[model samples]
Target: MSDNFPPPPPEQPQPEPERPVPVQPSPWAAPAAPPGKQRTGLIVTLAVGGGLVVAGAVVALVYAAMSSVQDSIALPPRSETPYSEPYEEEPYEEEPYAEGPSATEADAKKDVTITACTRDPQIGWQSAKVKVVNGSSTTASYTIMMEFLDEDGVKVAEGGAGVVDLEPGASAVKKAQGLGEVPPGTTCRIGDVWRTPSDRSGS
Candidate 1:
Protein backbone atom coordinates (compact mmCIF):
# COMPACT_ATOMS: atom_id res chain seq x y z
CA MET A 1 0.00 0.00 0.00
CA SER A 2 1.65 3.12 -1.21
CA ASP A 3 1.01 6.16 0.94
CA ASN A 4 0.32 8.21 -2.07
CA PHE A 5 -2.32 5.83 -3.21
CA PRO A 6 -5.78 6.19 -1.42
CA PRO A 7 -6.51 3.41 0.88
CA PRO A 8 -9.40 1.44 -0.11
CA PRO A 9 -12.55 3.09 1.28
CA PRO A 10 -13.67 1.49 4.50
CA GLU A 11 -16.74 -0.73 3.99
CA GLN A 12 -19.94 1.10 5.28
CA PRO A 13 -22.26 -1.10 7.43
CA GLN A 14 -26.02 -1.11 6.31
CA PRO A 15 -28.42 0.43 8.89
CA GLU A 16 -30.79 -2.16 10.73
CA PRO A 17 -34.69 -1.71 10.36
CA GLU A 18 -36.31 0.07 13.45
CA ARG A 19 -38.52 -2.22 15.72
CA PRO A 20 -42.33 -1.30 15.99
CA VAL A 21 -43.36 0.12 19.48
CA PRO A 22 -46.45 -1.46 21.35
CA VAL A 23 -49.14 1.20 22.09
CA GLN A 24 -51.83 0.95 24.94
CA PRO A 25 -55.39 2.02 23.95
CA SER A 26 -56.89 4.91 25.98
CA PRO A 27 -59.68 3.90 28.59
CA TRP A 28 -61.65 7.18 28.02
CA ALA A 29 -62.01 6.55 24.28
CA ALA A 30 -65.16 4.24 24.29
CA PRO A 31 -67.80 4.49 21.50
CA ALA A 32 -70.27 7.30 22.16
CA ALA A 33 -74.03 6.52 22.53
CA PRO A 34 -76.70 8.25 20.37
CA PRO A 35 -77.49 11.82 21.42
CA GLY A 36 -81.22 11.14 21.52
CA LYS A 37 -80.88 8.07 23.79
CA GLN A 38 -78.51 9.82 26.23
CA ARG A 39 -80.77 12.82 26.45
CA THR A 40 -83.87 10.58 27.07
CA GLY A 41 -82.22 8.66 29.94
CA LEU A 42 -81.10 11.85 31.70
CA ILE A 43 -84.61 13.34 31.39
CA VAL A 44 -86.33 10.20 32.76
CA THR A 45 -84.05 10.01 35.80
CA LEU A 46 -84.60 13.64 36.67
CA ALA A 47 -88.35 13.30 36.21
CA VAL A 48 -88.61 10.34 38.63
CA GLY A 49 -86.57 12.05 41.33
CA GLY A 50 -88.51 15.31 41.02
CA GLY A 51 -91.82 13.46 41.21
CA LEU A 52 -90.86 11.70 44.46
CA VAL A 53 -89.77 14.95 46.08
CA VAL A 54 -92.96 16.68 45.02
CA ALA A 55 -95.07 13.87 46.45
CA GLY A 56 -93.34 14.07 49.82
CA ALA A 57 -93.84 17.84 49.98
CA VAL A 58 -97.50 17.51 49.12
CA VAL A 59 -98.06 14.97 51.90
CA ALA A 60 -96.38 17.20 54.48
CA LEU A 61 -98.40 20.21 53.39
CA VAL A 62 -101.69 18.30 53.64
CA TYR A 63 -100.93 17.05 57.12
CA ALA A 64 -100.02 20.54 58.32
CA ALA A 65 -103.24 22.01 56.88
CA MET A 66 -105.43 19.39 58.56
CA SER A 67 -103.77 19.91 61.91
CA SER A 68 -104.26 23.65 61.73
CA VAL A 69 -107.95 23.29 60.82
CA GLN A 70 -108.62 20.89 63.69
CA ASP A 71 -106.92 23.18 66.18
CA SER A 72 -108.99 26.18 65.03
CA ILE A 73 -112.38 24.47 65.31
CA ALA A 74 -114.63 25.00 68.35
CA LEU A 75 -117.73 23.23 69.74
CA PRO A 76 -120.86 24.64 71.42
CA PRO A 77 -121.65 24.04 75.12
CA ARG A 78 -124.45 21.53 75.83
CA SER A 79 -125.84 23.42 78.83
CA GLU A 80 -126.58 26.54 76.76
CA THR A 81 -129.36 24.76 74.81
CA PRO A 82 -132.92 24.59 76.20
CA TYR A 83 -134.54 21.15 76.24
CA SER A 84 -138.08 21.78 77.56
CA GLU A 85 -141.12 23.34 75.83
CA PRO A 86 -142.51 26.75 76.86
CA TYR A 87 -146.18 25.86 77.37
CA GLU A 88 -148.53 25.22 80.31
CA GLU A 89 -149.65 21.78 81.53
CA GLU A 90 -153.17 20.42 81.89
CA PRO A 91 -155.24 20.80 85.12
CA TYR A 92 -156.26 18.10 87.62
CA GLU A 93 -159.81 16.70 88.10
CA GLU A 94 -161.64 14.88 90.90
CA GLU A 95 -164.86 12.99 91.78
CA PRO A 96 -168.25 14.61 92.61
CA TYR A 97 -169.37 14.80 96.27
CA ALA A 98 -173.16 14.92 95.76
CA GLU A 99 -174.04 11.20 95.31
CA GLY A 100 -174.80 10.15 98.96
CA PRO A 101 -177.54 11.18 101.44
CA SER A 102 -178.29 14.55 103.09
CA ALA A 103 -180.73 16.07 105.59
CA THR A 104 -182.06 19.59 105.91
CA GLU A 105 -183.93 21.66 108.53
CA ALA A 106 -186.84 22.52 106.14
CA ASP A 107 -188.62 19.12 106.02
CA ALA A 108 -191.18 17.37 108.40
CA LYS A 109 -193.33 20.64 108.44
CA LYS A 110 -190.96 21.90 111.15
CA ASP A 111 -187.22 22.41 111.73
CA VAL A 112 -184.80 19.71 110.60
CA THR A 113 -181.08 19.00 111.10
CA ILE A 114 -178.79 17.98 108.15
CA THR A 115 -175.95 15.56 108.78
CA ALA A 116 -173.59 13.04 107.09
CA CYS A 117 -174.41 9.36 107.46
CA THR A 118 -171.54 7.19 106.13
CA ARG A 119 -168.07 8.32 105.08
CA ASP A 120 -166.76 4.86 104.14
CA PRO A 121 -167.59 2.53 101.21
CA GLN A 122 -170.64 0.24 101.64
CA ILE A 123 -170.85 -3.33 100.34
CA GLY A 124 -174.35 -3.24 98.61
CA TRP A 125 -176.94 -0.61 99.50
CA GLN A 126 -175.54 2.43 101.27
CA SER A 127 -177.65 5.03 103.07
CA ALA A 128 -177.26 7.98 105.53
CA LYS A 129 -180.00 9.55 107.65
CA VAL A 130 -180.74 13.00 109.14
CA LYS A 131 -182.69 14.15 112.24
CA VAL A 132 -185.39 16.77 112.63
CA VAL A 133 -185.10 19.33 115.42
CA ASN A 134 -187.31 22.33 116.18
CA GLY A 135 -184.64 24.90 117.06
CA SER A 136 -185.83 28.08 115.32
CA SER A 137 -188.96 30.03 116.32
CA THR A 138 -189.83 30.72 112.62
CA THR A 139 -190.34 28.47 109.58
CA ALA A 140 -187.24 27.46 107.52
CA SER A 141 -186.83 26.31 103.93
CA TYR A 142 -184.05 23.94 102.81
CA THR A 143 -182.54 23.43 99.34
CA ILE A 144 -179.61 21.02 99.61
CA MET A 145 -177.37 19.59 96.89
CA MET A 146 -174.95 16.65 97.41
CA GLU A 147 -172.03 15.06 95.54
CA PHE A 148 -170.01 11.84 95.99
CA LEU A 149 -166.21 11.46 95.51
CA ASP A 150 -164.54 8.06 95.26
CA GLU A 151 -161.03 6.93 96.26
CA ASP A 152 -159.42 8.24 93.05
CA GLY A 153 -161.01 11.69 93.52
CA VAL A 154 -163.31 11.22 90.51
CA LYS A 155 -167.01 12.24 90.56
CA VAL A 156 -168.99 8.97 90.92
CA ALA A 157 -172.46 10.36 91.74
CA GLU A 158 -174.44 13.50 92.62
CA GLY A 159 -178.02 14.49 93.60
CA GLY A 160 -180.13 17.25 95.22
CA ALA A 161 -183.40 17.77 97.17
CA GLY A 162 -185.49 20.71 98.43
CA VAL A 163 -188.06 21.45 101.18
CA VAL A 164 -190.26 24.57 100.87
CA ASP A 165 -191.97 26.55 103.70
CA LEU A 166 -190.90 24.16 106.46
CA GLU A 167 -192.23 25.06 109.93
CA PRO A 168 -189.74 26.48 112.42
CA GLY A 169 -186.94 23.98 113.05
CA ALA A 170 -188.63 21.39 110.75
CA SER A 171 -186.19 18.82 109.14
CA ALA A 172 -186.30 16.57 106.05
CA VAL A 173 -184.36 13.50 104.84
CA LYS A 174 -183.07 13.03 101.29
CA LYS A 175 -180.81 10.49 99.45
CA ALA A 176 -178.87 10.18 96.12
CA GLN A 177 -178.09 6.96 94.18
CA GLY A 178 -176.11 5.97 91.08
CA LEU A 179 -174.67 2.88 89.23
CA GLY A 180 -170.98 3.78 88.66
CA GLU A 181 -167.92 1.87 89.93
CA VAL A 182 -165.82 3.63 92.55
CA PRO A 183 -162.04 3.81 92.14
CA PRO A 184 -159.51 3.42 94.92
CA GLY A 185 -157.05 5.83 96.60
CA THR A 186 -159.42 8.41 98.15
CA THR A 187 -162.02 8.88 100.95
CA CYS A 188 -165.75 9.75 100.74
CA ARG A 189 -167.28 13.10 101.77
CA ILE A 190 -170.58 15.01 101.28
CA GLY A 191 -170.10 18.15 99.19
CA ASP A 192 -172.17 21.40 99.33
CA VAL A 193 -174.22 22.21 96.22
CA TRP A 194 -174.42 25.65 94.58
CA ARG A 195 -177.53 26.96 92.79
CA THR A 196 -175.93 26.95 89.36
CA PRO A 197 -174.71 23.99 87.22
CA SER A 198 -171.47 25.80 86.40
CA ASP A 199 -170.66 26.01 90.07
CA ARG A 200 -171.25 22.31 90.56
CA SER A 201 -169.19 21.39 87.47
CA GLY A 202 -166.31 23.60 88.57
CA SER A 203 -166.34 22.14 92.05
Candidate 2:
Protein backbone atom coordinates (compact mmCIF):
# COMPACT_ATOMS: atom_id res chain seq x y z
CA MET A 1 0.00 0.00 0.00
CA SER A 2 2.89 2.51 0.62
CA ASP A 3 4.46 1.91 -2.95
CA ASN A 4 1.08 2.67 -4.72
CA PHE A 5 0.66 6.06 -2.84
CA PRO A 6 4.13 7.32 -3.91
CA PRO A 7 3.52 6.59 -7.69
CA PRO A 8 0.23 8.60 -7.58
CA PRO A 9 2.08 11.86 -6.54
CA PRO A 10 4.33 11.97 -9.74
CA GLU A 11 1.50 13.20 -12.09
CA GLN A 12 2.07 17.09 -11.69
CA PRO A 13 3.82 18.98 -14.77
CA GLN A 14 6.47 21.86 -14.65
CA PRO A 15 6.74 25.11 -17.01
CA GLU A 16 10.10 26.63 -18.46
CA PRO A 17 10.90 30.51 -18.90
CA GLU A 18 11.04 32.12 -22.47
CA ARG A 19 14.52 32.98 -23.86
CA PRO A 20 15.36 36.09 -26.24
CA VAL A 21 16.84 35.58 -29.78
CA PRO A 22 20.53 36.66 -30.42
CA VAL A 23 21.08 39.64 -32.96
CA GLN A 24 23.79 39.64 -35.77
CA PRO A 25 26.06 42.70 -36.41
CA SER A 26 25.22 45.09 -39.44
CA PRO A 27 26.98 44.40 -42.79
CA TRP A 28 27.67 48.21 -43.40
CA ALA A 29 29.91 48.67 -40.33
CA ALA A 30 33.36 50.15 -41.14
CA PRO A 31 36.22 47.65 -41.61
CA ALA A 32 39.79 48.11 -40.44
CA ALA A 33 41.67 49.88 -43.39
CA PRO A 34 44.83 48.16 -44.70
CA PRO A 35 48.17 49.81 -43.81
CA GLY A 36 49.34 49.57 -47.49
CA LYS A 37 46.26 51.48 -48.72
CA GLN A 38 46.78 54.25 -46.15
CA ARG A 39 50.44 54.50 -47.10
CA THR A 40 49.47 54.77 -50.84
CA GLY A 41 47.23 57.77 -50.13
CA LEU A 42 49.97 59.51 -48.17
CA ILE A 43 52.45 58.89 -51.02
CA VAL A 44 49.97 60.39 -53.52
CA THR A 45 49.58 63.57 -51.44
CA LEU A 46 53.35 63.98 -51.14
CA ALA A 47 53.71 63.46 -54.91
CA VAL A 48 51.14 66.19 -55.62
CA GLY A 49 52.90 68.62 -53.28
CA GLY A 50 56.27 67.85 -54.90
CA GLY A 51 54.78 68.34 -58.36
CA LEU A 52 53.40 71.73 -57.35
CA VAL A 53 56.81 72.78 -56.02
CA VAL A 54 58.46 71.68 -59.29
CA ALA A 55 55.89 73.61 -61.28
CA GLY A 56 56.51 76.73 -59.21
CA ALA A 57 60.28 76.38 -59.79
CA VAL A 58 59.70 75.97 -63.54
CA VAL A 59 57.54 79.09 -63.59
CA ALA A 60 60.20 81.04 -61.72
CA LEU A 61 62.86 79.87 -64.21
CA VAL A 62 60.66 80.91 -67.13
CA TYR A 63 60.13 84.33 -65.64
CA ALA A 64 63.85 84.76 -65.09
CA ALA A 65 64.56 83.73 -68.69
CA MET A 66 62.05 86.24 -70.04
CA SER A 67 63.52 89.01 -67.93
CA SER A 68 67.03 88.18 -69.10
CA VAL A 69 65.89 88.14 -72.74
CA GLN A 70 64.26 91.51 -72.35
CA ASP A 71 67.39 92.97 -70.82
CA SER A 72 69.59 91.59 -73.62
CA ILE A 73 67.72 93.47 -76.33
CA ALA A 74 69.57 96.55 -77.65
CA LEU A 75 67.96 99.97 -78.07
CA PRO A 76 69.16 103.15 -79.64
CA PRO A 77 69.98 106.06 -77.37
CA ARG A 78 67.46 108.88 -77.22
CA SER A 79 68.22 112.47 -78.10
CA GLU A 80 67.03 115.50 -76.10
CA THR A 81 67.04 117.97 -78.99
CA PRO A 82 64.33 117.91 -81.62
CA TYR A 83 65.37 116.40 -84.89
CA SER A 84 65.33 118.26 -88.24
CA GLU A 85 66.16 117.47 -91.83
CA PRO A 86 69.82 117.52 -92.74
CA TYR A 87 71.00 120.63 -94.53
CA GLU A 88 72.18 120.24 -98.09
CA GLU A 89 75.07 122.23 -99.48
CA GLU A 90 73.56 122.37 -102.95
CA PRO A 91 70.40 124.43 -103.28
CA TYR A 92 67.13 122.96 -104.58
CA GLU A 93 66.15 123.78 -108.14
CA GLU A 94 62.67 124.13 -109.62
CA GLU A 95 61.22 123.15 -112.97
CA PRO A 96 61.17 125.51 -115.95
CA TYR A 97 58.04 127.57 -116.65
CA ALA A 98 56.33 129.52 -119.44
CA GLU A 99 54.88 132.98 -118.85
CA GLY A 100 51.13 133.59 -119.33
CA PRO A 101 50.26 136.38 -116.88
CA SER A 102 52.05 138.71 -114.51
CA ALA A 103 52.32 137.67 -110.83
CA THR A 104 51.47 141.21 -109.64
CA GLU A 105 47.76 141.30 -110.56
CA ALA A 106 45.21 139.42 -108.45
CA ASP A 107 43.11 138.41 -111.54
CA ALA A 108 46.18 137.82 -113.73
CA LYS A 109 45.94 134.66 -115.79
CA LYS A 110 48.62 132.24 -114.74
CA ASP A 111 50.05 129.17 -116.41
CA VAL A 112 51.45 127.71 -113.21
CA THR A 113 50.63 128.04 -109.56
CA ILE A 114 52.46 127.77 -106.29
CA THR A 115 51.54 124.66 -104.37
CA ALA A 116 53.20 124.68 -100.93
CA CYS A 117 55.76 126.63 -98.95
CA THR A 118 56.93 126.91 -95.33
CA ARG A 119 59.73 128.11 -93.08
CA ASP A 120 61.53 126.73 -90.03
CA PRO A 121 63.74 128.33 -87.44
CA GLN A 122 67.19 126.92 -86.90
CA ILE A 123 69.51 127.11 -83.90
CA GLY A 124 71.86 129.53 -85.63
CA TRP A 125 70.02 130.55 -88.79
CA GLN A 126 66.47 130.94 -90.02
CA SER A 127 65.08 129.11 -93.08
CA ALA A 128 62.34 130.06 -95.51
CA LYS A 129 60.65 128.58 -98.58
CA VAL A 130 58.73 130.03 -101.55
CA LYS A 131 56.85 128.62 -104.52
CA VAL A 132 56.44 130.54 -107.78
CA VAL A 133 53.89 130.05 -110.58
CA ASN A 134 54.39 130.46 -114.30
CA GLY A 135 51.49 132.61 -115.52
CA SER A 136 52.66 133.01 -119.08
CA SER A 137 51.74 131.39 -122.42
CA THR A 138 55.39 130.66 -123.36
CA THR A 139 58.31 129.25 -121.38
CA ALA A 140 60.25 131.89 -119.47
CA SER A 141 63.39 132.18 -117.31
CA TYR A 142 63.46 134.06 -114.02
CA THR A 143 65.12 134.28 -110.60
CA ILE A 144 63.78 134.53 -107.04
CA MET A 145 65.56 136.83 -104.60
CA MET A 146 64.70 136.91 -100.87
CA GLU A 147 65.77 139.92 -98.84
CA PHE A 148 65.71 139.89 -95.03
CA LEU A 149 65.22 143.26 -93.51
CA ASP A 150 65.56 144.73 -90.00
CA GLU A 151 63.04 146.87 -88.10
CA ASP A 152 64.70 150.00 -89.54
CA GLY A 153 63.75 148.85 -93.05
CA VAL A 154 67.39 147.99 -93.74
CA LYS A 155 68.26 144.84 -95.68
CA VAL A 156 70.29 142.37 -93.66
CA ALA A 157 70.46 139.09 -95.55
CA GLU A 158 69.87 138.10 -99.17
CA GLY A 159 68.93 134.68 -100.49
CA GLY A 160 68.28 133.13 -103.93
CA ALA A 161 70.18 134.57 -106.87
CA GLY A 162 70.15 131.66 -109.30
CA VAL A 163 68.09 131.68 -112.49
CA VAL A 164 64.85 129.60 -112.75
CA ASP A 165 63.30 128.50 -116.00
CA LEU A 166 59.75 127.15 -116.20
CA GLU A 167 57.80 125.34 -118.92
CA PRO A 168 54.42 126.54 -120.05
CA GLY A 169 51.92 126.19 -117.18
CA ALA A 170 54.72 124.85 -114.95
CA SER A 171 56.19 125.95 -111.61
CA ALA A 172 59.75 126.37 -110.30
CA VAL A 173 61.66 126.93 -107.03
CA LYS A 174 64.68 129.08 -106.24
CA LYS A 175 66.92 128.51 -103.20
CA ALA A 176 69.69 130.71 -101.96
CA GLN A 177 71.83 131.75 -98.95
CA GLY A 178 72.40 134.93 -97.02
CA LEU A 179 75.61 136.84 -96.41
CA GLY A 180 74.59 138.62 -93.22
CA GLU A 181 72.51 137.92 -90.10
CA VAL A 182 68.71 137.51 -89.95
CA PRO A 183 66.74 140.13 -88.08
CA PRO A 184 63.40 140.01 -86.27
CA GLY A 185 60.45 142.13 -87.31
CA THR A 186 56.66 142.30 -86.86
CA THR A 187 56.03 142.77 -90.61
CA CYS A 188 57.41 140.53 -93.34
CA ARG A 189 57.36 140.79 -97.14
CA ILE A 190 58.56 138.76 -100.12
CA GLY A 191 60.38 140.59 -102.90
CA ASP A 192 61.96 139.76 -106.24
CA VAL A 193 64.71 142.39 -106.07
CA TRP A 194 67.98 141.63 -104.28
CA ARG A 195 70.24 144.28 -102.80
CA THR A 196 73.92 144.10 -103.52
CA PRO A 197 76.57 144.42 -100.81
CA SER A 198 77.73 147.72 -102.15
CA ASP A 199 74.19 149.04 -102.25
CA ARG A 200 73.44 147.90 -98.71
CA SER A 201 76.66 149.37 -97.35
CA GLY A 202 76.00 152.63 -99.17
CA SER A 203 72.62 152.98 -97.50
Clash counts for all predictions: 22, 18
- lDDT per residue, candidate 1, 85-201, as tens digits? 788878877655543333332333233334653433664322334343435464444445445566666766655555544455455566544234444432334444322111133
State the lDDT of candidate 2 residue by residue for 34-137, as single tens digits.
99988998999999999999999999999999999999998788888898999878877865333332343332223222333223345333334555555656
User: For candidate 1, which ten residues in a row score worst on lDDT?
Assistant: 193-202
* Model 1 CA deviation exceeding 4 Å by range: 1-128, 131-137, 178-188, 193-203
Residue 145 local lDDT, model 1: 47
The models' CA-based lDDT, in order, is 0.53, 0.53
Q: Count residue pairs with overlapping backbones in model 2.
A: 18
- Ten contiguous residues minimizing lDDT sum, candidate 2: 194-203
